[model samples]
Target: MRRLAPLILWALACSAAAAADVSGRVSTAADGVNVVPLAEGSVIEVVLTTSGGEQVRTFAARDGAFALAGVPAGRHVVSAYNSRFVFPEVHVDVTASGVQAAALVFNGAPIPASPLVIRPAGVAQYYEARKAVDVVGFIKTPYGLMIAFSVFAMVVMPMMKVDPEEYREAMSSLRGGDGGGAVEQSGGGGRSGGGGARSGGGMQPTGAGAQRRQIRDR
Candidate 1:
């Protein structure tokens, strides 16, 4: 029974972190510090070594981000290196599932340390839960082949409708505010369309003279 103590504790820990996701990105430099994403859809080697020398699991996934589930909390050293000679190595520490750290920004050699993980596990869960880019199918017919590139673009491109310019404009407008009362500033210049709309929203009496109708009649 004594030998089973550690095993039992391990089992419990795994169960606790089963729903926990642990992942992060390794950049070549700071945010937009001028480094390409390691590789597009290329799996890099990730080796995790713990202080206790546990046989940690490693996975080969796309370069932008990586994840490992069921991580029993402690000081964990995660080393990620791409197979191809492109981006530099990215090292990160998973102090636990609750510590907020910096995003692993990779640049030249001598990679600097960043507190990329406030809650390491939470960050990983967020990236993993995010839906990946979806690519659509293309036809092989002559006409289809002629525009196959366009079809490929349509599929590969992210379905984002919000234009950056429009979003910035809206943000700027909100910051400036609505300039107080918009309706009051209308100066009764135009026909009382605003009043008419409000009146329409309320119950307009069928045989009314000029008196406003009550809302309950609706």
Candidate 2:
């Protein structure tokens, strides 16, 4: 047991020397100095990624402060995550001495004076709200007007009543005003004791001889 005790102590010391603690504050400012007011129930997740593909995650406090203990000494990257906001990846160097804050980058460009501060670049919008329909405004458009006219023709016009005599008179007046034709009647001489009638200008007999013949036949 005594021989194993020395080996256990040496192993513990080496492990302690290899790991370090990384501490920083995640703020809404680029300089990591000014702290912004966060929304209620807002939670920011701080992640520490080592060069060896190891990751350690923790939540930031209400004041945006975070700490990851027992992180292996090496070059590492610190980043913040949230659904509502976008965060830039921060490069941090962790050694046996302490955690050294480095440049924070966004889109390959270094942000000046922004060390550990993780401000959101912009708000993320996953969905768009539907717009409410405006009946009056729609009716003012050309398509809407066309639809309204179609509805009026299909629904309202059929429900209306018209007198046959009035419709015939209106049609006759329209035709006469346009010089469409004239109605002519022969003297009463047909077998039915009624005058023979012809309609339309071109359909009637033109010459005097044809007129006399038509009259005699009638």
Candidate 3:
């Protein structure tokens, strides 16, 4: 019975030590030093890879902090992502006592005492989601295309109108002159009328000419 008691006590201690926590805060690094919490109502998820299998835990951040309890102790790779962007992977060697402090930053700053792992999954998922959003936002549906075309017509189409100088030259060429064909015809008519008036005056014999001929006969 004494030997059995010692064995049981050792087993319980081992069990308790093996079950440790992995917890941390998620933040955005600004100016490489200032830290800001993620947007309100955003989703936070952590992916932990263990020898047994991959474990995923998702939770809403409260005051920009998250905690995973009872994480199996081992060498685990931690990958975290949100609806908008993903943080770089954090690698931690989980021992009998677990990783109690972990910080994931999106700002590309160095974290002290934290193993930074290369991103293999979170970045791919983030880009895929962003691509899906861009596709839907631009040309995924008829309405989206319609909106795009409408914007083009309203903003860009007006800029494509004929140039003012080119337009004036085209109209002048079509009319055959700068003042148009009508002005040419009107000017020709005025010249012809002047010639006719001079001829008519000569044919009528002016009064001065008649008076001079009568005085010469006297």
**lDDT string, candidate 3, 6-41, tens digits:** 999999888787977766665545334555455667
Clashing pairs in 2: none
Q: Rank the candidates by TM-score, best first.
A: 2, 3, 1
In terms of lDDT, the poorest run of 10 residues in model 3 is 115-124
Q: Which is the winner by lDDT between candidate 2 and candidate 3? A: 2
After superposition, which runs of candidate 3 have C-alpha atoms over 4 Å from their true positions? 1-13, 34-40, 100-110, 113-218
Best by TM-score: 2
Best by lDDT: 2
Q: Candidate 2 — which residues are off by over 4 angstroms? A: 1-8, 29-36, 105-115, 128-218
Instruction: Kindly give the stretch of ten consecutive residues in candidate 1 with the minimal lDDT sum.
Output: 117-126
User: Per-candidate TM vs. native?
Assistant: 0.33, 0.48, 0.40
The number of clashing residue pairs in model 1 is 18
